[model samples]
Target: MTNSWSYSSTDNLWKPPATIIRSLINCVSKNGNLLINVCPDGNGIVPEQAVETMREVGAWMKKNGESIYGAGAADYPTPEWGRYTQKGETLYAHVTDQPIGNISLRGLRGRVREGRLVATNTDVLICEYWNPEVQTLDGPEDIFFNFARPTAWTYPLPDESATVVAFRLNDDEGTRTERQRLDEVRMRI
Candidate 1:
């Protein structure tokens, strides 16, 4: 469910309605992908507001894309902020809004090896995992509140002013082997 807006007419040029963005987010939340279009003006320049909005979206995606690409519909029992996805033994948390300090996984009982901001090629940080025995997460709320880790890495977008970011989730046993087998088969052909 891609959300695209065209500036073919003046009435719609220069700005995409907020409803479009909201719908695109809804599509993403439902385990779908959004391919938004960024049309250039007659002078071949992107508007400044569009550029700023895209940057904000990219920042949010950089930190929370894991949940969007890796999680399933049932994985996120509660939707406090963003969507989520699960691949194999790992669960991803896609945060739309920047955390004030730290993010909490209230009902997660799985063994988490680590958690880190996506969109950057770096080592994954091994934070405290959820302990069923303890019946509570072992971490300061500030950690989740300040979830967005600043970095110099930037994602290359089709348009420099395009908004939106994405992340993937890596779980135990690595990627699914069946998908690998299919990839090998396609490559052979």
Candidate 2:
């Protein structure tokens, strides 16, 4: 079953409760998208509160939309605090909560060319590399050995209450054999 609800404020500033935002994050984490609506006044102007809320939501999207839009789920040895999406040689990572820092993905065996913060108009952040000395159970590995500090890229929510961040992975040199193998395993199930 599906459910829906609505909120309205004639005062032109309608802030959905924090509970609502938390719910949204949870939904997105579970592979769901949120469709928020802000009704404009009869004069066709969105309420100030509504605008602020939108800005905040936009910030979250700017930072984390990559994982929500089309990220894939993979099991890793370590707990990754973000979600990820991939298209061909491009992989997107969405970091909803956490201070910006180097991100590491162990047990990865794929060729990665470069890493970038997606919302920042394709700014290159990390140059990808592979370590022949390390290997996953499958075989040779190409893990994100080092992720430098995240670029200054960030989505400033309209409300200015929080921020969201995203990163992209480029593997155009045919280095996703590990991902392909994982796909094969899923198909069998």
Task: Give candidate 2's total backbone clashes.
Answer: 7
Worst lDDT 10-window in candidate 1: 142-151
> After superposition, which runs of candidate 2 have C-alpha atoms over 4 Å from their true positions?
1-4, 8-31, 39-46, 56-79, 99-101, 121-142, 145-189
lDDT of 1 by residue, 1-189 (tens): 113355443443433434344444566557676766766667887656567667766665564455455545545564465545555555554445433333445543223344544455343322222222232334422112122232112223222222222223334423336455335423522
Model number with the top TM-score: 2
- For each candidate, give its TM-score against the true structure: 0.42, 0.46
Off by over 4 Å in 1: 1-7, 12-25, 35-74, 123-189
For all candidates in order, the CA lDDT equals 0.42, 0.43
**Candidate 2, residue 72: CA error in Å?**
6.4
